[model samples]
Target: MSDYVTYDESDHVVTLTLNAPEKRNAISTFADCDAVVEAVRRVNRDRGVRAVILTGAGTAFCAGGDLKAMRDRKGIIEGSHADLRENYRRGVQAMANALYECDAPTIAAVNGPAIGLGLDVACMCDIRIASEKARFAESFIKVGIVPGDGGAWLLPRVVGMSMACELSFTGDQIDAATAKEIRLVSRVVPHDELLPAARALAARIAANPPEMVRMTKRLLREGQHMRLSSLLEISAAYQALAHSTEDHKEAVSAMLEKREPRFTGR
Candidate 1:
């Protein structure tokens, strides 16, 4: 219910837009990331929401964690209240984990600047599509702090260790085209068409069976680290699970009939 975060649904896609554009969509001192977790949870289990697209309102997608908020957190740490800092740390990590574990397909439509915590959020998503106006940076080094949330873990996996090191160490921003070239984002569209493109992609994903889609995402994330033989074993188990769904029967029947299968996600 944060005024800073707006949630809406179109067809089967749920969109969460960072609504605080006036401060360059900075998710600072306010409870912005916590609000995001709630919104995503609301959409995650909702049968009507088969896919999700995350973006920012106004100019920049997010200027990263509100610097002012970080300052306040530093003040708390300096106060020698160890318990308080630990509790706050858990809250922040929860927000990052929510973005990572969201069951449906998650897309970050980076319509503008993404710095610090903003980069964490974008990397947590399953896919990223940026606008030509988008600018990306891992700004922790510039502020003389390590990435407080999940950036340390996610960046290296998205980009290789060497490239991730360079970005985090320098804190220089990269343009959308460069982001795509580095595989930080999958595609870059014009600013005006960013949301439209994201929504179109969401629709295409939502057209598939929800059960299979969820399993496919789970398989990719959980299976990435396993050996080839392990993956083959797990993949067969996944296919067995997929075969139990009514959507699978419909797909087979439709193939036999030479028609498109309309999956109900049941």
Candidate 2:
């Protein structure tokens, strides 16, 4: 919606690109936060969208907060202590919620450095694909601030508590290889091949029945905080709904006929 973020859709995949290349795609202003949340909302409600990819426009995937803004007390940084807490709630935190709650599977194609809030943004995605030039850090500490955008919760879930603690405490940037080794990114490709790799994975995910894909993602998200018994109940309900869809019937019929399934996302 804003110049801070741009949206594109093709072949059942929606791509949301952070557009402020001059700022290294920083989520500094309210418009930046709103643009991301709006884009995620759009993709979530579009049943035709089976998957989504998030990336940046230029060299850096996202450099996180605009240090200039912080120094000048402009953008999100311009506020009293209570005002700043509220700003986090309605701004960056809301963006994180929109992303994590999105129905379509999300892949973050980290083209370059993803620091602080940017790193947290990548962690919010279900999958991460990084460029060879990509780097990552839970860098809030470096700025004498903590993760105000839910990084404390999201990062630990992504890279595990010990590794997350190490990154957050030190605010050290890690190479793409180290990110992959720590499970921060599922794949690392050449800088030029980043988007293609992410799209290929998205296409693979999109080939499935769309409703099933969404429901499966929902189940996975629920399982993260749910007990085994509660998750099983939720899974059973979702399975019933999935089994009753026309796409499920088509899938089975196509298998029986030895043909590729054509799903209508019913």
Candidate 3:
């Protein structure tokens, strides 16, 4: 994994921290994207990891792409037009896809600014919790570009098309309160409480059977794009598989015995 991202695991929850605070944790190069992708893949491979919290190392969560790199045509931004397109596919786009496809449910703990690609990355998570100091903006337009990191698809799904259009068109930054009002974040907490809140949430999710949580997340993702009937069929299959697990039997027995379930993730 690249040094730009740090991975920590505890109590079945994995925390992925963007480590570069000097540039406000901006994803500056293809290596940065690879770091994020590898972290997500690592979590997916570990069945014991029931939840993931994504946050940054210092004040800012992520300030989006490195502006200096963009201006100087350096890092991922350095290339011909065709080369740039390919770069995106291998870099930011790959990171986005990895997060979206991650088996463990992801919670983006937005500690500060989430601008342009940063906002898109937050949207890629299954849930977002923001700090009071957090700010969000669909700011690619301000940089004379569109949402090349899948913001166009993600923002609309998270905040509705009209709100996405307004944010994308204006490129105006919204404080945590406004972000919560528009459903960009599920909730907002004090700056110091951000990580704690995220961990608490992740812990709640991790308390359940790990396999069930993964299947449930998969079902939710599929439901977003599948027909209701098709989703029901898939759900039925998942339910049948779930019923066959040792954890499922333990859960049912615990309910009858009036005790907490001891799930083995079977």
- Candidate 3 C-alpha lDDT tens digits along 60-142: 99999999999999989987999999999999999999999999999999999998999999999999999999999999999
Per-residue lDDT of 203 in model 1: 95
lDDT of 3: 0.94
Worst 10 residues of 2 by lDDT: 38-47
Model 3 segments beyond 4 Å from truth? Answer: none
Better of 2 and 3 by lDDT: 3
What do the candidate models score in CA lDDT, each in turn?
0.84, 0.92, 0.94
- Compute the lDDT of residue 106 as modeled in candidate 1: 95
Clash numbers, per candidate: 1, 0, 0
Model 1 alpha-carbon drift over 4 Å, by segment: 72-88, 227-230
TM-score of each: 0.92, 0.98, 0.98
- On lDDT, the stronger of 1 and 3 is 3
Least well predicted 10-residue stretch by lDDT in candidate 1: 74-83
User: Which one wins by lDDT: 1 or 2?
Assistant: 2
Q: Regarding TM-score, does 1 or 2 come out ahead?
A: 2
Off by over 4 Å in 2: none
> What overall lDDT, based on C-alpha atoms, would model 1 receive against the true structure?
0.84
User: lDDT tens digits, residues 151-177, model 1?
Assistant: 988999998899899999999889999
Worst 10 residues of 3 by lDDT: 1-10
